[model samples]
Target: MRRQTARLYLAALSKYCGSRLGKLLGVGCGNGEFLAEASLKGFDVSGLDVSADAVQTTNTLLGREVARCSTIERAGLPDHHFDVCVCGYVIEHTREPLEFLSEVHHVLKPDGVLLLVTAASGSRPVTLENALLRTGFRSVEMMTSASRVLVLARARVRRPRPLVSVIVPVHNEHRTVARLLETLTAKELTGADKEIIVVESNSNDGSRVDVLRFAGTPGVQIVLQDRPLGKGSAVRQGLRHARGDIILIQDADLEYEIDDYDSVIEPVRTFQCAVVLGSRHSGNGKIRVFADQWLLGLVFNSGHVILTGLFNLLYRQALKDPWTMYKVFRSDCLHNLKFECNRFNFDVELLAKLIRKGHTPLEVPVNYRSRSFKEGKKIRVISDPWTWVWACLKYRVVSPYGGDCTRRTENEMGDVPDTP
Candidate 1:
């Protein structure tokens, strides 16, 4: 029965890695059945078993020194030495599954494969699959056999798809909310996997109802904020619930084009910078708002230039439009920033804190169309400039260890309830 089981597992492993001869490491070579089968199938095999007697028996049976008595966590094996590592029915026995799997990960070559077999009766299967994903394994497959399940995961040495969280802050703009949501969900932006989290504040203008229309859509989450917190607050709320590898700020207003999302995220994907900002005034003719087009536009555009210049001077980073609504950053960057601004000053605080952490944001040219205040624009010309100036200076001196400024609620912020 043991030899038959070994042949069945070898068949499955052969399906993925092909019948090619390579090095294989078995975590628990009980009585040497599996490694013996691998050896017959043209693999140079080594193994680790907890029992010294079992190791000696396996070595004697194989007629070579193939099995070692060692724990997976402290296997003392050289790195990048094995092409495949097999842990059959051994993960549940390990006290530290993650650490043990990480050790396996460290030992495998760049394109190495890890095959895990566990009983299907308990929570072990689910827990093991989650552990594989969290440990930087690229592709994970779950297959079932008689009374057992197999998890085949491949090691990713370098690049992997970055999961993006698109935080859309919605207010009273009933006219464009639905269209915005459609654009976000209809097309795949950046060619990278992403999820949309819409944080809706108290909008009496039916914008909340419009967003609820897409509640049934996959990857679309509608978060309802009880009060009229500012856009910054809504974004902060979304950040707490985001599970993506990258955090991208999306505006609900129609001023920023959704088509620019690819360009905004490209910098991070190419590894040029950890943070990226979409600039409207980057000499792109596609930029819909020009200084000569509208007087109010010119004033705000000039203010943006001045503020961006001040950020460059103080932060020693050259960013053309620091206040641009389209900002894409790595999720880990948030660890250095204790976000407090529940309003427009959130962008200012983000720029200041990121600069203080010594990260320079790469600016990418993207299309933008400025909306007039009469067309549901929210920023106040008189007060916003002062807020931005104060936030930029204040965040530079404040330590991130001071704790996050926003409060969290027990509500399922990412839950999309039954669509009403």
Candidate 2:
């Protein structure tokens, strides 16, 4: 199982590395744990550790030209020195990580790969390298999880873009579920592995009758909530069973356009980010015009903007629309995330929680359409928004990751990455 996961991690890395056997540089590579593993796989490898003792250990273990070095460039390596340079866990331990990364970029060939992995130091979005985007590169790809960091970048210059996901949260949205399914089925599903998961919560609504409707589809699945959970619970519930390479939360209602899917999935697909938010209103004059439930939709979206913006300001991270139903994420990166809300504000709470958990949401635009309260719309003018706001503020104001992971993982069966 451990070997299987390492292969998956390697296969995933090759999507960026583009080579199997090539010159490898392990920088600040103490004791050469990660590097030794790679060298054992039969690649020509070398190590440069900041600690003299660690460098001696690497030479003893791998019998490579391990050297005592403080910087990547002075490691006595040749120009365009390596095919891939891997600097794991040591980036965060440095005062000038970019200087380290710059040394890395200088040593790699034009087609060379740099796999730099770091753990999030604090529960905040921006980190060491993000503070120095212009040191030597124009575009890059970064993949992050609750505790891991992975980045892909170029040394010279080019255009940069972000990958996106379409998130749709559903509770008992069975009535119009087929509209969403058929619309996605009719799109250009051939180019990418697009997916839709219908979150069927503990619905007393006749919608569950409609949920069992799509049991035969190949890509789409209906995930039922455990216990009597809420809309957020259903969304959280479905995520456990979601198999999308990238997760897009799709509502059963077909009010949104099927054509808008491509622009949304690109950034994350290209390794730009982990979460991509689909915005209903963005980049003016480019508007989505709709008629039914016009006034209520307007009020709902207006309230949504105010709520999300307030959330961004409060959380200390730049997240847009904390309450939007359509949010997307990379499937593997979301592992081990704990959500609090059993209802709607779960989006708001999750956003703020991610901010504290050292992640951020990249907002992208999408079309918006809403139905009347009589037409199956669920947002009510009661204390619901207040409940969401309180949860958002409370979680944002506190530290959430200090909890015990073993206790948390005990109840979540598939939440942890299984090596096999």
Q: Find the candidate with the highest lDDT and give its number.
A: 1
lDDT tens digits, residues 1-420, model 2? 133433444554566546567777777667665566666676677777767888887677667665465666566567676777777666677777667676676787765666665664462324433432434432344555656545555444222322122334555666776566666656664246655566666566766666667676765666666555666776776766665556776666666666767776776565566667777656442232336556655666667667767776777656544555666665544534566677767777666655655557788877766556676666556778898779867886654543523111222222334321
Best by TM-score: 1
The digit string of per-residue lDDT tens for model 1 on 384-411 reads: 8899888877776775435532111113
Please list the residue runs of candidate 2 whose C-alpha ends up more than 4 Å from where it truly belongs after superposition.
1-171, 202-206, 226-228, 282-302, 316-320, 402-420
TM-scores for all candidates?
A: 0.60, 0.59
Question: lDDT of each structure?
Answer: 0.76, 0.60
lDDT, residue 256, model 2: 65
Residue pairs whose backbone atoms clash in candidate 1:
none
